[model samples]
Target: MKNYPQAARILVAIDCIIFGFDGKEIKLLLIKRNFEPEKGKWSLMGGFVNEDEDLSDGAARILYNLTGLKNIYVEQLETFGKARRDPGERTVSVVFSALIKIDAHDSEAVRSHNASWIALDARPKLIFDHEEMVARAIEHLKYNAALHPIGFELLPERFTIPQLQKLYEAIYNIPIDRRNFSRKLLSTGLLIDTGDKNNNGATKKATLYKLDTEKYKANFHSFWNFMPDSMKE
Candidate 1:
């Protein structure tokens, strides 16, 4: 192999912006760094890309290590190559967007890593360019949620129509018409009536439904247009 002139060695890192939605609100998974230039401060879960591992595999490993969960929805959002982004070193980070069922993660693993689920509006000031990454993730989420059924990643296997509506409302931060929303959702044929009701409610219980896995998987890429014209932007 012919040797070329010396090239600058820079680090490549992976940062994940994990979003979770409960029946009420959307949340973010953040870690309080225990060691480094920004110790004891909140930041996105991340690590350096190992020399021997593929980028996607490295991201999955890091995510599993932090959340103790697998098979979660993950997508490569964008790459941040700003030279001065990381104060500890010259690093280019590939930011990833992830969504997981909030109640499914192992609490012990999250505690071990000093990570917590923070409300989107109440999140602490993050270190480095993490804030920018999160903003972009939210923008991407709103854009995608309007067109695809990606919001299902944050819900449980069985949920009520109201619960599903709440999740979408949380994502777009807007109110939805119950009659129209329910009618539109049922028209998709992607929901299966589970023959169960949410008995936990004090008032009248709402019927429960589950995703028709075959249909959801088959039509995931199709445009949903679930939101109104005013909210589509």
Candidate 2:
């Protein structure tokens, strides 16, 4: 009657689909393969689960190791267990997606493993079931965008209203009504106008706004028209 007799065998792995928005296009962080099975190809940052670590901890460790990013907003995505998913071994990958501000981390380390931020619209062929993982991650992002306030995580601290609108449009892949979008966003009172205008390449200067972090974090669950009729459950 030993506890070891009741132990279960489970294979777990962490795959990170890091999403970044660079003002115009939505991009995904991909790392080129350095080992066999798919050497010299693009893939998501991932690693095997450790013996004494939780799934999230393993994911954070993998991300930290690859890009020196920490405390990012990581969420569990899906579990891929197709028999032929891995050619080297029979394993289950627990995928995680994170939204990181492009300017938050050092870019040099990220570029070391041939890492590059490829625009989602122009992504190359990916290895294993990673393409599927990225698709699911985008869907999750869309769904979450309609409900949660996670979109701000992908933007810089100080951003223009147009930039914010562009981020939303990029995530949804649909053009939002400019006037209505701006009105609704301003009505939320989550943004603090810095009273500063950006003079970078525009005839008319745009006012810069930053997320009132304390206010946002405190009242993130406030009522809003986030979810559409389809997502209502």
Candidate 3:
């Protein structure tokens, strides 16, 4: 090992992109910045990493501190290390993307940060590189939704077929043919009708369904098609 001069100190931070789905749209959780260099602007939940903490731990801690949510489905995204990324310090940031049910977490701490869920299509301008971070997170979500069953994370335990279709439509940002969509999803045999109906003032009650986890696990290989030529590599 070689010794160098004392001018090489670097700082590390963790930023979390928390994505939520209402029945209609994909939304992002944003906090109003309270510090200088972007004060009063919208930003992702983030903080400096403590000396003894792992990057994942730091990301989780920051999210919990801001939103009081723990054990969410978070995955490590790319690290951003552009030299001028932060004007206040030589900082490198490890970003994480999380998918969570919109109403599953504590809301008090989030309110303290002036946090709000904004629809992805109508998000406010964010501070720092947070906009880039969100773009990457959306890309990751789109890819993962095509290949895995992770889209269920954005929904409640039990949902109707229409609800499931709406979730996929929100992720894809396009209209899906109701007939084809219903045919494909029903043919999968991964959904079980619960013998119940969602009777929330609709003219006709729609049947509720839940995932057959065992079957989903067994047939996952044939359930998803991520290699479609239309998907960008």
Candidate 4:
């Protein structure tokens, strides 16, 4: 076996910033660092990419290992390649942001890894460049959720308009006008009346609706300012 004489050793890694909505606030799935260099501290779920695995496959493997959910909204956000980013090695990392429904993931898997869903705003200082990665992912979410309906990935299949509004408000950190949000959302023709209602122990029962799959696919990338003017206030 022959190797390049002057080539330096470098390791590839994947870091996934998992986001979820528990119907009230948006949160991030982070793990307690289990190995030293920074053991026992909070960190993003990450792992070294296997020699034979592609980058995307490595990311999916890491996500599945932590959440036990697949085919969700996963997007590659950026790459961090600072020479000494990893105190232990010369590693370059690819960052991914995943949006998952909080109730759908495997809690046992989450616990096995010492992971917790901490509120996005309340997450503690992360180990390394991960804090920057999450901040970038947050901006990415705001930018895309305003133009697309990807936020639905953080919601249940059947939800009320108010539930949807809460998801957006969590994402944008803004209070949306009830009538305005409902009017804008309904006019898009993306939701289908399921003829079911959820009161959730409330005095008023709200109608449950699901996405019109066809319309959702058609408009997934189309621009619609779901971010209303109320956000400016």
Candidate 5:
């Protein structure tokens, strides 16, 4: 085997920014570090990559260790390789963004790792470069939510248009016009009226709707202008 004569030996790490929407607010899953180099501080669920594992597999393993769920919606957000990013070692971190249904995750798995879900806007100070990774994840969420149907990943199996609207509002931190919002979403033809109603809201019960599973899976990547102009860059 041939090796590069002057190749730098740097460690590789994978950190996940897990986002969830609980009907009304967007939240993040964070862990209270249990080891040195910032033990007890809020941090992302992360670990060093194993020598024989692939990048995505390593990310999935880290997420599973913290959430006890598999086959989740995960993507590589960015790679942070700042020389001094890790105070304890010279490591290049690959950040992943995962969207999950908050209620479906295993609470015991999170508890085992000293992890908790924090409202996105109310999160505490994070360790190392975790905060920056979270900010980038938020930007990615907002950007993709505007152009794709990815927001539905954070919602329940069945929900009303108002509930979906609130999810988007929470993601962008802005209120959407009710009338246009409903019309636009309906026009997508991705929602199937479930003949049910949401009896949980303070106001009158709203009709329940579920995704058109066939259409959703087929058109998940198509462009959809769901964000309000004010929220756009």
Candidate 6:
């Protein structure tokens, strides 16, 4: 192998900002660093990219290692390459943002990795520039949610209209009118009647619905003007 002798050495790291929805509020998956400069501090799930490994592959590997999940929605969020970002080394990090259903991940893997699903609003301080990475990921999530079928990725296979409304309220951190919200979602025709009710079997249980995934894929980029009046800037 040939190398540039005059070039400086640099390390590459992949960090995952994994978000989940637990039928209430948004949550972040964080791990307690078991080694290094800040061993006990909360941190995003991350790992160093291996020799000959692709960046996306490294991100996927890191996420799966922590959550025992695969084939989930993952997108490259940003690159953080500020000098001395990692006190232990001169490293550049590529970040990936993932949204997973809270009930679908492996509980054992999370416990083994010392990872916990912390509510976004109540998360603790994180190591390095991971806090900034999380803020940026939230921005991207908000942006994408306005133009994409975000619930399809984070919510369960079947959920009530109120559940969907609660998700939007959590993401935007604002109150939304329930009547208008339900009306708007039904107008989109993106939701399909599942002919089922909430599992608890409440007498007045809300009907459950699922995304019309086929229609979504047919016009994947067509979800527009989806934000409620309060959600818009």
Better of 3 and 4 by lDDT: 4
Task: Give the TM-score comparing model 3 with the true structure, all chains together.
Answer: 0.87
The predicted structure with the larger TM-score, 2 or 3, is: 2
Model 4 clashes, total count: 0
Ranking by lDDT: 4, 5, 1, 6, 2, 3
lDDT of 1 by residue, 1-233 (tens): 13745767789999999999867889999999999899999999999999899989988998899888887899999999999999999999999999999889988999999999999999999999999999999999998988888877899898888888888889888888888888888998989898878887532388888888898889999988877545645
All models: lDDT? Answer: 0.89, 0.84, 0.82, 0.89, 0.89, 0.88
lDDT of 5 by residue, 49-134 (tens): 99999999999999888888899899998999989998998999999999999988999999999999999889999988888999
How much is the lDDT of residue 191 in candidate 3? 86
Q: TM-scores across all candidates?
A: 0.95, 0.90, 0.87, 0.95, 0.94, 0.95
lDDT of 4 at 158: 89
For 94-174, candidate 3 gives per-residue lDDT tens digits of: 999988888776778778888999999999998878899989889888888887777777878788878877888889877
Give residue 64's lDDT in candidate 2 (0 to 100): 80
Question: Between which residue pairs do clashes occur in model 1?
Answer: none
Candidate 2's TM-score reads 0.90
Which residue segments of model 5 deviate by more than 4 Å?
1-6
- Which regions of candidate 4 fall more than 4 Å away from where they truly are? 1-3, 201-204
Assess the local accuracy of residue 24 in candidate 5 as a C-alpha lDDT between 0 and 100. Answer: 73
For model 2, residues 17-132, the per-residue Cα lDDT tens digits are 99999888899989889998899989998889988999999999888876688998888988999977988777799999988888887688787767899999999999999999
List candidate 6 segments past 4 Å from native. 201-204
Task: Score residue 41 of candidate 6 by CA lDDT.
Answer: 95
> What's model 6's overall lDDT?
0.88
Question: Model 3 scores what on Cα lDDT?
Answer: 0.82
lDDT of 4 by residue, 11-80 (tens): 8899999999988899999999888889999999999999899998889999999999988889888999
